[model samples]
Target: MNSEGGKVVCVTGASGYVASWIVKLLLLRGYTVRATVRNPSDTAKTEHLLALEGAKERLKVFKADLLEEFSFEQAIQGCDAVFHTASPVKFTVMDPQTELIDPAVKGTIDVLDTCRKISSVKRVILTSSMAAVLIRQPPLEPNDVVDETFFSDPSVCIESKLWYQLSKTLAENVAWQFAKDNGMDMVVINPGYIIGPLLLPTLNLSVEIIVDMVKGKNPLNCRYYRFVDVRDVALAHVKALESPSANGRYIISGQSVTINHIKETMRELFPDLCIDDMNGEGLMDGINCTMCVDKVKNLGVEFTPLKSSLRDTIISLKEKCLL
Candidate 1:
C-alpha cells in the first residue's frame, strides 16, 4: 500500500520493454503500482522489476495471463488506473488465430472484463499500435495524414497476408467496442515502430530494424516508418492517464524516417563500426505514413528525436552484447 495516498496504477505485462519503463516511471513518481506478469515465480523474469527504484516499497507483481479470463482482477482491484500494454507482437506467425488473434483479442477481453468488475479503475490506457491503423489502399499520396479517425482495414490486411496488423486491428476494435458498451473511461495510445533501450536481453521485433542495421545485416534503408522511443511511448501512457480532458485515441509516433537516416548518423558518430552506404536511400517503400500526434501533443507530450532514440538503442544493445 502507498503511504502517500498516491494513485495505485496497474500495468499489465510489467516485464515487457515498454511496460517495464511505465512501471519504473510510476514508482519513481510515488505511485503504488500493481504489476501483472505471466510468471511471477520466474526469478529471471521478475528480478528486473524487483530491482527497480521503489519496487520493494511501492511495486507489487502478480501473475496474470491474457488467455485466462478474470486473471487480472487481483492486480486491478482498487486501482485508479490500468495501463493495458500487453499484446502479442510477433512478425512470424505459424497460426494466426492461435498465435496472434487469440492472444491479442482474448487478452483484451480478459483485461476489460477485469475493469468492468472493478469500479476503482477510473482510466484505462490501452497500448494500441499504428499496425491497427496503417492498412489502407497504398499508392498512398503524401500528406494523407492518419490520425484518430482512421482505422486499418482487417479484410485488406488479411487478404494481403499481414497477420500482425490484422490482429492489432481486430484487437483494438474489440477493445473500443467493449469500452463503449460498458460506459468505461478509456483512452488508446497508438504508437508506431516502438524502438528504445532493452531492459532484458531478448530482442523485440520493432527494435530489430536498428539492431540489424548496426550489425551490418541491412546495408541500406529501403522503407520508412514513423518511429517513437519506447520511453516516449511510456510517457504518453502516463500523460493519457493524468490528463482529464484526454479521450478517444491519440497517435504516439514521431516524424517519418528510414533506417538509412539512422545508419548514416551512426556512421558519423562511430566511425570505427563497419556501417557504410551512408548516402543510399532505397526505393521509397511502404505506406507514405503521415501520422498526426496533435491530440497527444495537446496533452503536453513531446516525442524524443529519432537520432537520439536510435543512438540510445544502439548503445544499450552494445552494453548488453546484443549488437
Candidate 2:
C-alpha cells in the first residue's frame, strides 16, 4: 500500500445512486474514503458497497443526516477533501421552499460549516445537476450550446414545476457564496442525466425511470434527454479534486440524444423483451442540450457515450436479476 497516496476523502450521501459511484472510484484509486449514510446500522443498505473491491481496508461508513446539525463533523475529520453529494431531489412540489430548497441549501451550508472547523480539508467537490444551470435559461432558439458561463435565471425557474432544479441551483449558489466567504477551495460538477451500473440490487429513483422503461413501465412514451454516464461523472469528481486548476463549475455530460433514441437502443439490444410499451415520440421535440463540456475535458477527463452506458446498465440489470 502507498502510504503517501492515501489522501483521506469524505463523500456525503455515499449510499445514494450517484454518490455510490463516486465512492467506488475513490476506493478503486486507493483513497481512504469516509462515506456518510443516514443509517449506518442498516447493513443491508450498504452491503453492496462493503462488498466492493477495497471496501474492507479503504472505506469507512459514517452515520449522518442532512436535516441534522453537526452530524457531518466526524466524517469530515482527517479528510483532505470532501465530496458533498447529499441533497433531496424532487421534481414536483406543493411547497418549493420546504420540499426542495431548504434541504438543498441547508445541507450544503451544514457540510461547509463543519468543514470550516477542519483544517485538513483543502477542497470540496460538490455535485450540482445540469438542471441547476439549464432550467433558468429561456427557450433555446436552435442548437444553442450553453457552457459553464451560463446560469439559470431564477425568474424563469419559478414558472416551471422544476422544484428539483431550483433546489440544486439554490444549494449550489449557497456553496459558492459560503466558499467565497470562508476561503474554502470548492469545485462544482454539473452533470446531465446520470446513467450507469447499479451498486445495489434495488435501483434508486433516477435509475428506476430507465429500468421502468426497460420493463415497459412508462406508457406516455416520452423520450428526450442527453444522458451522462455516472461513472464518468464520478471520475470528474476525482479529477476535479486532484487537478489544481479545476476550480469553479464543470458540466459533465456525454453524447446528447433523445428519449426515442434510448428506447430504440434498448429495444435493439433486448428484442426478446417487450419493446411495444415504449413510445418513440412521447418526448418533447427540439429540446436543446448543447451544454459545452470543454471545461471538464481540459482537466483530462473523458466521458462514456450514452449508448455504451445504456448497454452497460442493461447488462448490470440482467446480472442483478432486475431485467
Q: What does candidate 1's lDDT look like per residue over 9-109, in tens digits? A: 89998888898888888888899999998999987668888999999999999999988888899999999989998888887889999999998999998
Any runs in candidate 1 off by more than 4 Å, and if so which?
A: 1-4, 219-221, 276-284
- In order of appearance, the predictions have TM-scores of 0.93, 0.92
Worst 10 residues of 2 by lDDT: 278-287
Candidate 2 differs from the real structure by a C-alpha RMSD in angstroms, to one decimal, of 2.4
For model 2, the stretches where C-alpha displacement exceeds 4 angstroms are 1-3, 93-95, 215-223, 277-283
lDDT of 2 by residue, 1-323 (tens): 12256899899988887888888888888889899999988876688789888999999999998888999999999989999999987665788888778888898999999998999988999999887777645576447888897777666777776678778888888899999998889999998777788887676666666777776555224445667888888889989988878889999876656666778888887788675554444455544556689999998788776778888888887788876
How well does model 2 score by local distance difference test? 0.81
The TM-score leader among the candidates is: 1
Clash count (model 1, backbone only): 0
* lDDT (Cα atoms) of all candidates against the true structure: 0.83, 0.81
Q: After superposition, how far is residue 39 of candidate 2 from its true place, in Å?
A: 0.5
